[model samples]
Target: MSRSLKFALLITLRGFSWYIRHVTKSFLGRGQVPVIDSDAHVVETERTWEFIDGNDIRFKPVLASARSEPNNYRWLVDDKLRRRAMLSDIDHLRPVDRNTQTPEDAREMSDIQSRLNHMDQLGIDVQVLHNTLFIEQVADRIEVDVAVCKAWNRWLADIWSKGNGRFRWSCVLPLTSINDALDQMRFAKDNGAVAVCMRPIESTRTLPDIYFYPIYEEAERLNMAIAVHIANGNSAVCDVLRSPYDPGASFGMFRAMTAVSCHSYMVSELPQKFPLLRWGFIEASAQWGPWVAHEARRRYEASGKVFPDNPFAEFRVYVTCQNDDDLDYIVGYVGEDNLLIGTDYGHFDPSSEIDAISILKSRTDLSTSLINKIVDFNPRNFYAI
Candidate 1:
């Protein structure tokens, strides 16, 4: 055979081998236990933008190329860089096709049947979806942000409502205005939002502040869980609400915010204040719980300020983990009952895009029961689903 024919044959064999391997793994990953992904994000389609209704295309944040950079896209509003939206969901475990950018890229993130099929391939039983680009874009734009969030939530509900039971989602609250936030939240509950999502980074106000108390109260009353999914904190410039919308947080803020907020809630007796409230700090990983618990102990030793309850107690605290996190320490410090597993599906940069539970499911260091808790039972308990 000529060299060209040999090359063609080699490519065909490789393609066939990949298909066989993929099919086999997809079949094998269907687990007996349901895996609930506590924090999965979706790239919003133009369905979300439809609610904007002739707003200046420039001022309205939209996805655009990162100034000619290859394989990168950023959220830009009036030419100001907001955040890098995931341009692809290609799993790095395999060779990636970089030309996969399109609004249809969002179908894997937002479409009901597409996501369900992806979940089956990954061994995930259910995924709790959160908003992607817009959450950070609207962080500081106030009323403008409110409109964007309102549109996005409506679009989200319309799609997830059709998901049967496979897709559950939290709505993004209009955090800039109290009235707006409350109104949209009611709308969210009516539309079937299971929780409310906020970025863990310090917003115009830190989450534990009294300004957020009312939101927390309403969430508690509505039986809506609160989720603080991680964001870069670089994108937010919260202009509404109060005067000191702290702009101090950066990419490194999620871990610090998780520690600080939980500590504050415990120290200031927030768990008691909003006793029925539930919170999850997600995508920040689960490694910090022990350190924060130790600091709480240190402060207690130094100042004798005793918390009415352990902040790490199962009722008030939940944190999401990657397979690489020290699961043993997390369970020891925060309790296995409080853990949540987030595949971060479709978040291409750091997310495992495929088989989010395979690591824990296959871990020799963990017991089958502990694996089950992290992948299945714990998330259900956290979400009360």
Candidate 2:
């Protein structure tokens, strides 16, 4: 059958399995319970999976211009980079539809239905939505960029606002101009954005470029944390992987890995100059945290004395760790305060919010207090929720 029908069938099967597990756990009294503390008792449910799946939804924005480029796929080649610059192509990367509905129209409902079913199976609370590949779409446009940003932001608020207070959002900004970006930040805050998202590629300039200070200031003013993320194959690093010298290698496998290294370098430098700015690197994976911290510290110790104006002074940058053991090392280096959890769920990954929570709880070396901080507290503290 078609992709849409396949997804629908999968959702139905997953939902049925989830109901069985939910009833079985409640009947056997094998449900997870809340931990009590001096301040409050945290209650978990056997039906927690159902609640999480039912409540949490994913929102992905599409940029209409990113998919139109002739050399879009070939842009991965180094020689083609010059050709891409000359073409100045822009188009939206359309999502694959399994049915007659447009991807944008169907993505939220489909993702919510699938995610809710998975959440019921996994016992998660909720998931905040983010865009798929809009970052790459807006990277090159300077003129009329604000309009494109507004279009995506308005669509997200309109479609996902019915989720009561459970649905959260990451807003898109027009970074071509600092003034325009500041206005967009205000617009996003008024429209219920939980965080502001941008690419880490420095397409216009480095994150610390003085031109963007007003944008950072606006984010801090609105109490929304800045999230720097990367769409696959949007940077020069991806070109290195697609080189003829390594034709057998897959481009998709190395995109995030390469972007994470580039992002670490950018993060190490941005915070020192904008010390008040709270930032998180999303979709960059949790494993790189310790190395980033170690490298930043090493470089600072070696040259910090010589360059007193450096931005890496006692820096405390926050990062979202995917459920993994590398988080154990990241927390050891950055401390519990700097780590948060994100499953990058609601996509191909069937793991739900509960699965992420279980992973967090499974860290026996970590205290209940620490787990609570990672699961709920850190995000609230960072986003000022």
Q: Give the root-mean-square deviation of each candidate in angstroms.
A: 13.7, 14.4
**What is the lDDT of every predicted structure here?**
0.64, 0.49
Q: How well is each residue in 1-385 modelled by candidate 1, as lDDT tens digits?
A: 7542353344346434533442334444654666677877777544467655366333456777755685566666545666565544433423263212223444434456666666666677667888777445444667576777777777777776676656678888766788888998998888767788866544546666788878888988876778877653434333332134554433344445555666655555566687666778777777888777777777766776664244566236788877778787678788866788876666543434345576668889988888777776666655655
lDDT of 2: 0.49
Candidate 2 global Cα RMSD: 14.4
TM-scores of all predicted structures: 0.77, 0.62
Best by TM-score: 1
Q: How many collisions per candidate?
A: 1, 15
